[model samples]
Target: MADAVALRQALAAFLGDTQYRKFVARGMYRGRMAYWQEQEWTRFTTAHPEFAVDLNELAAALLVCHLHGDELKPDTAEVFHGCMDLARWYVEARSRLFPYAAQDVISTEGRPFEGDRIGVLFCPACRVARAGWRRR
Candidate 1:
């Protein structure tokens, strides 16, 4: 069975089911929407019960498709990590710029959120990067 122990251990060079599932969740709050899939949402939520990310296009497309070509690119891991870095800035900036009145305030509006247009994320692809722009 692929568990925490198995995931920490990297015997194979290829991206395994366990690893891919985790990656789905990581880019989730960060970026790498191009790699996300609806099916993987379950695994992501299960693996990271502590996180309370909403399953929305905005969260999914937090980062633009900075990546090009194959899903299993040699530097794919780095790209995922890159999202992790952006996540921090996102939180801080959101607080100052968006300044959610409440935790749920972030949800009041939808993607293409009314914030600064900075490509702090991967590609500023989604509605932000996903949409080819960036949220504050």
Candidate 2:
């Protein structure tokens, strides 16, 4: 199959399954509205290897659509753009919220001290740090 079709199929499979779709939607709707890092994307797809190729290709295409050809290439950008408003909502909602209270839990050995870990936070689809702190 052509690369685009294969990638789309992969993405469709990922999106067709409720759980996998929810995870991608969460990342796209949550976190920052920026392109995800290669490491992060690989990590996420590794957790769902069945859709690894599709996710990687789809994500790359979405980045291209998002960055260029937004005006004259609306159709090409629809999939990624579909998540823009939701991302905006996440950004705004998190911005209006309050910061979480600092905890005194025992630190894990060798783990970086970057304040709180993203796992404990109410993460959006992006999986990166949110724009601000907010109570869940």
Say which candidate scores most in lDDT: 2
Tens digit of per-residue lDDT, candidate 2, span 1-136: 1254444345446445553333343434333423443454576467656545544445443431111112111111111111123366654644433111112133345544454332232222221223323323
In terms of lDDT, model 1 sits at 0.33
lDDT measured at residue 45 in model 2 versus the true structure, 0 to 100? 61
When summed lDDT is taken over every stretch of 10 residues in candidate 2, the lowest stretch is 69-78
Please write out the lDDT profile of model 1 over residues 37-123, one tens digit for every residue.
Answer: 444545554665443255453343322222221122111111121112336776675444332112111231233444432223222
Q: Which has the greatest TM-score?
A: 1
Give model 2's TM-score versus the native structure: 0.22
